[model samples]
Target: MKLFKNTFLSATLTGLLLAASWPTYGFPLLIFIAFIPLLMAEQNIRVSGTQKKLRVWANAYWAFLIWNLITTWWLINADLFGMLFANLVNTLLMSLLFLLYHSIAKRVNQILSLIFLITLWICFEKLHLIWDFSWPWLNLGNVFSDYPQWVQWYEFTGTFGGTLWIWIANAFGFYALVQNLSRKTAQFILIISIPLVLSLWMYTTYHSTGKTKEVIVLQPNVDPYKEKYAIPNLEVARGLLQQTDSLITPNTEYILAPETVLAQNLPFGNFEYSEVRSLLRDYIYLHPKAQFLWGIDSYDLVYDSKEVTPSSNFVRDNLWVNNYNAALFINRNPAYQKYLKSKLVVGIENLPYKPILEPLIGNLMIDLGGTISTKTTQKERSVFTGDDGTKVAPVICYESVYGEYVTGYVKNNAQFLAIITNDAWWSDTQGHKQHLSLAQLRAIETRRDIARSANTGISAFINQKGDIISRTQYNEKTALRGLVHLNDVKTFYVRFGDYIAYAALPVMIVLFLFGITRRKKSPSYYWPR
Candidate 1:
């Protein structure tokens, strides 16, 4: 009973420490020692001289569930059932991975145990990034988002590097605490200090490389629930035009608006007859230099059988309609361009395991702002070409959260990053703030300037160093114009993409085999100094 009490206290401490290290309002430094308590508790259970394996999983689940609720409970604002499902399932996945680590540690010696733990965890993070049930919201590396000055070295390592850095620090701190080594402070200090030092140096010394262009980001502040669907698309466009007319200069190169701003659906093949298109065309005719990009609700009509896809929704016997939450970029040069959002929000934008689940629950789907069916996505990252040959990546709301996925734009010669989003779904919570902050990490990783336009969250310009240069207040109906650097350079991370996670996969495989084949080891050998 006493042992269980101690472990429970320790698990709670881990949960609080991690929550305290979160972005926007929390002190990020706490993440270094946050996991030490959980590690100590697990270690104590290993040497408790009893069968307490179940205790490890129970304690881990408690700690992780607490972390999830504290950080992301605002998801309840959108859908009550969705919030609970996300928290429960994500927590289950986290605890299950930790249980695998505990299982390997029971059989292997300390060095091999720790090796397997770190490697397997990295592999899990990689899976969370690209897998079918993709959700990377709480990936450990995101802790440094609010403090971009401390992780400026992300250009080379990306967020996976930060994940590896956090794990190593915790492992060393736990080991030092166990050994009571006052003399081993040097190694532990170096582990925590080196990344910050390098980051600061880079943050101070690095200069942005590229031409500067003027950008105007519009935050029309349309309430998604109340006014967004109520008003006509032409009314919204004219309102946005009034805001843009006040900000545009002779040199304004790009004008960006929020996601899904066009409430009226347009035919996918041709947008000539679209009412909002004519309103925007008149505005663009006046400003010849300004290229406009905004989000819209549109669809494709597939009459031919060969044109049908897995995501195409059936309208009748032979006709199929494919709805898209898409971005449209227009200029006088090539006329217009389009890119569909691919990385979808779990239940809101996409149905998980759609093929398998759609059969069981036919025609039952959740609709937020877009359609109920699964959104169609393109295989490649599409880049919108600027008027004067500057390449701009038109990243949609949820798509901006992906690191490697954004790099696909850089690979295709995107000189700058432009994000359009509607953030009123969660309404005045950490959801918008965290979403804005996560864009900072992408800026650091790609070494490119960013201009983010949110409907009611925030519209801002971020520099190459992940620093917010200019921003609008949340929920404000406003517009911001700033000079953003357009760069054609690619960082190591942009070229190689999550190399730290890549290096750990093979090592994890070897250690997993070793742990599985070896017999259970003595308590003394189960942990290392």
Candidate 2:
């Protein structure tokens, strides 16, 4: 009874430490300590010989479930029903992952067990990134973004490497706590500490070779509820243009405004209509010298009927809804390019699993800006060339989260990254911070300077080494003008993606096989709940 009480308290304490170390407080070292108590709980389950392996897993999972629920409750604001489902599903997934670790630890030696846990944890992280209903937001590596210096090594291996580093630290710390081999455990800790200490050394000393450029980012602080939809289209356009004009100067080679700043009632590409054409012409004339990149909605006409509706077999459905979440690149020389956002946010931007849920949800099309519903057509990566022939990869808002997607441009020789976003909807929550934090990884991944322009919040310049050189205030109606760096040099992560995660898988398989071959010789022990 005393052991049970001690174990439960230890597990819960570990869970709390893990949650507290996330993006909220930015203390990633807390994660290295967080799992020590939980590992002790596992050791108690085995060394004390009180509970069956399965029962121990169930109890550990319950503690982790509680931790997940308490920490991620903010997801409810995104969509109440969606949040509930995500919490239940993700908790179950995490529990199964923990089960694999516990089962493997049953047969392996201490060194092998530690390696197994690290491999298992990273495999699960990779699974979440690729799964159709992926939620890569809460990755343990993301916790390190608060100490930007520690994650500078991301240029080599991406955030997954950071995940490995943290887990290895925790494993050593746990080994020190659970066993009584003072000298042996000290040796183990020293071995593990080598990598951790080296990462810190590398973090402080890393540098990048990249050229910088001067750019201006404007955030009007337009209220999502009031200013976005309250007034007439012409009134909103005038306000945005006036604000943009004030921020522009001779040195500002490029200017950026938030997503959907121009509130045209009609669809974006109804340009045959004089009103729409006039708006584009006026915008073009306003910023004559500087190249301006901003988000807008557009519907392009398709001449080839088959090309129009690629998904439909019948040409009768040829008038396909060519809706897009798009960005327009306008230069002083009357050159313009349009790039549609490829990766859409699951719930808010695109309906989650529309084909499966549409029958139950009753035409789940919630219109925001124009008459046409939010739809997807062709998805493309965009790079815009300025009047001075400076080329940039334009990352539209959510696309910044996808490291591989941004790196694809690096492989093609993109000079800089320009991300335009409307973060007003998320405000000061972890949502905004998480979004800003992840952008750092992309810069490190691609080895390219990032000019991030956000609405109602953090606009900043990120260097090739993933350092934020300059930034703007949250909720301020202001412009951040700075010299943004540019670089075409590619990092190892960009050249070879997910190498660490993939390499871990074979090691995990070996551990699994070793556990299977070394199954306990005695009859299975059982304990009642």
Candidate 3:
């Protein structure tokens, strides 16, 4: 009973440390040792020779539950059910990974067990990026986003490198604490210092010599619950034009508006007939040199003969339609292009396993006054080229959270990135702030400047080095104008993308197999009890 009590306390301490070390509020340095208490708790269970696997799993679940609830409790403002599902399900997944590590530890040596833990966690993060219920917002690598200068090397290894760095630091720190030896402690300090030193050196020496483009980002600040969908498309267009007229100059190359700024569902086939498009065309006529990128909720009709994908919404009379949360690019050219949002928010914009689960509890999900079904997506990443031959990638709201998804835009010759989002649905909470911070990681990984426009949230210009040059206050109707460097050079991460996680897949398999093949042994004390 005493041991169980101690274990629960240790778990709570681990969760508190992790929550207190997260971004937008906490110091990231605490993450270096955040997992030490939990590790110690597991070790104590193993050494006690009593219900080792069950105790470890229980303790891990408790720790992860506390961590998830504290760090992401703000999600409840968006949807109570979503918050509960995310917290409970994500904690279960994390605890399962730790349970796998505990099982492996009982069969292998300490070094192998540590390696297995790191590999499995990285793989889990990678899986989170592509799965239907993706929620990579809590990925360990993102903790350093508040301090971009400490992660300049993200240009090479992507966020997976940060994940690897944090795990290695925790392992060393845990070992040093258990051994209580001066040499081990010094080794832990050295491991933590080397990467930070290299990152600082790289940050100080790096320089941007690319061409500069003047960009204007608009934050309409229309309340999502009150004024956004309630207002007509023309009114929204007039508001955007007023903001643009105040901020845009002759040298301004691009004017960006936030996601779903045109709340009216425009038909994809008759986009030119939309009043918002007409207004934007007139605005572009006045500023002939400027290009406009804006977000729209659109739909396209399809007949019976047309092949339909999973996201297609069936209607009566042998007719079906595809709904898109998309970005529209307008210029002097008569024809405009649209890029549909590929990555979608679970339960809100997307229904996971729609064929199976939609029949179960689909009505519980909120539609936010747009499409009642899953959002349609394009297979290829599209880059919009201006009249002067400069290209910009239109990254819609939730899509910006994906690292490799943005790389595909760079690979298609996007010189800069424009992110348009409507974060008001989550209210003025950590949800919007954390979303804004993650864009800095994208800027670093692709080595491309970012013009981020958010409705009722943060609107800012981020440089190629992941520094915010200018920003607008949340919930304020304003516009941000700044110069963003246009880089043609691709970083290593942009070229290769999440190589660390990809490499870990086979290594994880090998380690798992090796552990299973080894003779099963009782837990031996790797640390003094």
Candidate 4:
């Protein structure tokens, strides 16, 4: 009877907590307090009868399964069959992790056990980031996305550290509210104060202001399926050129187009350099004042006949190699510079985990038509210089989530950010919105203005404070031309990268060790089934 009651309470609280994250049935306070009942249930089971360990582990697994399936049901949109199968696999993995957690918790002291759990959770989140079936989408750290102000410290520790903060707070808060007050109240108060102090520190540090620039973002509602198959390349190019004519105004300095806007690759370097040069010259001649930035598939061929040693040869250097996903910077003065995107999206763009999955999944199908696919492996940060020498760093679709990578660009002196994406793939689903929200953090991290252009979606200009000064509505083909701020003011996040979260790893290790050593301290606390 008691087992049923505890399981019921655990299931209910876990469900409620998970549901609080979904838009359909969400309550913010429920998100914070919901863990209390569930945590307490587990804590009570810790000191129960003989069979307590297995019972607690089983409930933990069940609760995690509930949390994941309830909150991340949207992953089903990936593929009906694959998503269901993936969820089952994920649930089982989570169950095993929880079982490990139960064993470790039993071995450690209370405080140490909490630390171990926190560390293990962080490690799991990190592992999910780069693993074979990597999906860092609904990481617990993202639950605090709505609470951006409290997460201002993410610039220093990254958002994974923010998850650690919340987990620690929950542990302390649970102790303060449920456990007896035996001078542990001070510890609880201190634990809760961490986020508060960091937020206050950030609030004070964000006072310095910077200059803003006028930029234009193009949200072209181009369906990849239709663009590639139904419509002719000429028709698409004509439409894009016509759209450019309609959108460009006197105030528009930087005009951004969505990814793959130029269906065909543009010639770069000295091969047909004259022709390549002529096309851009004509473009600049037509729009004599506007500085144009467009996403184009670019081709490169070296024609420099300068003699060099074998190793120093341009051919050997692969400088004359193939094309790249590139950004064209055409200034009104007839000057042009192209930048290739570096950080490619893992599965879609470049699969570093391709070898492992190739034998298993046997090539997943892209919904859009393509018999074979090419993997992009570009890793050099390409910076484009504006007419005034303002260096702009560009990240393509799905690359915005890599805040650490974006930080690397800022460190290398990329002033403004231009992210070209095609959200049309997801239609008007939460996928696009979530992707856009994640991009917002890039601005906060670097304190630079972001000019984002998306296909069939939310195009916006993000400011230094992570605020969107102007934004276009989703699912509309419209031009958003506004001044985007470009400031060199580097935030603390750039100085010290993901330090807070990484520091928790060692702390977690210590906690796990403590848990194992303290098993004898509570030998009489096991429960009978």
TM-score against truth, every candidate: 0.97, 0.85, 0.96, 0.81
Badly placed stretches (over 4 Å) of model 4 are 1-5, 22-30, 44-58, 85-93, 182-208, 228-234, 264-280, 297-326, 332-347, 359-362, 370-374, 513-529
- Evaluate residue 219 in candidate 2 and report its C-alpha lDDT on the 0 to 100 scale: 80
Pick by lDDT: 3 or 4, better one: 3
Error of 3 at 526 (Å): 4.1
Flag regions of model 3 displaced more than 4 Å.
Answer: 1-5, 359-364, 525-529
Every candidate's lDDT: 0.86, 0.69, 0.87, 0.64
**Model 3: per-residue lDDT, tens digit, 322-416?**
88999988888899988999998898878887777767875345656766677888899999998888889999988888898999999999999
- Candidate 3 is scored at a TM of 0.96
Predicted candidate 2 versus true structure: per-residue lDDT over 1-529, tens digit per residue? 2433477787788778878887755566677777777776775566545455775677567667776776666666556766676677787787677777776666767668778888988888888776556776767777776666666667777888778877877887666544544566666556456655766787667666656667888787877655675555556556656676666666677777776655444455453353534565676575556676777655554546656443221214445455666777776554467777777665555655655665588445434445334446344466787877788887878778776667777776778888888887644777677788788878767777788888788888887667788888889888877776667667788888888899999999888888878865221231112
Residue 262 in candidate 1, Cα distance off native in Å: 0.5
Candidate 2 collision pairs: 212-485, 213-484
Between candidates 1 and 2, name the one with more favorable lDDT: 1
lDDT value for model 1: 0.86
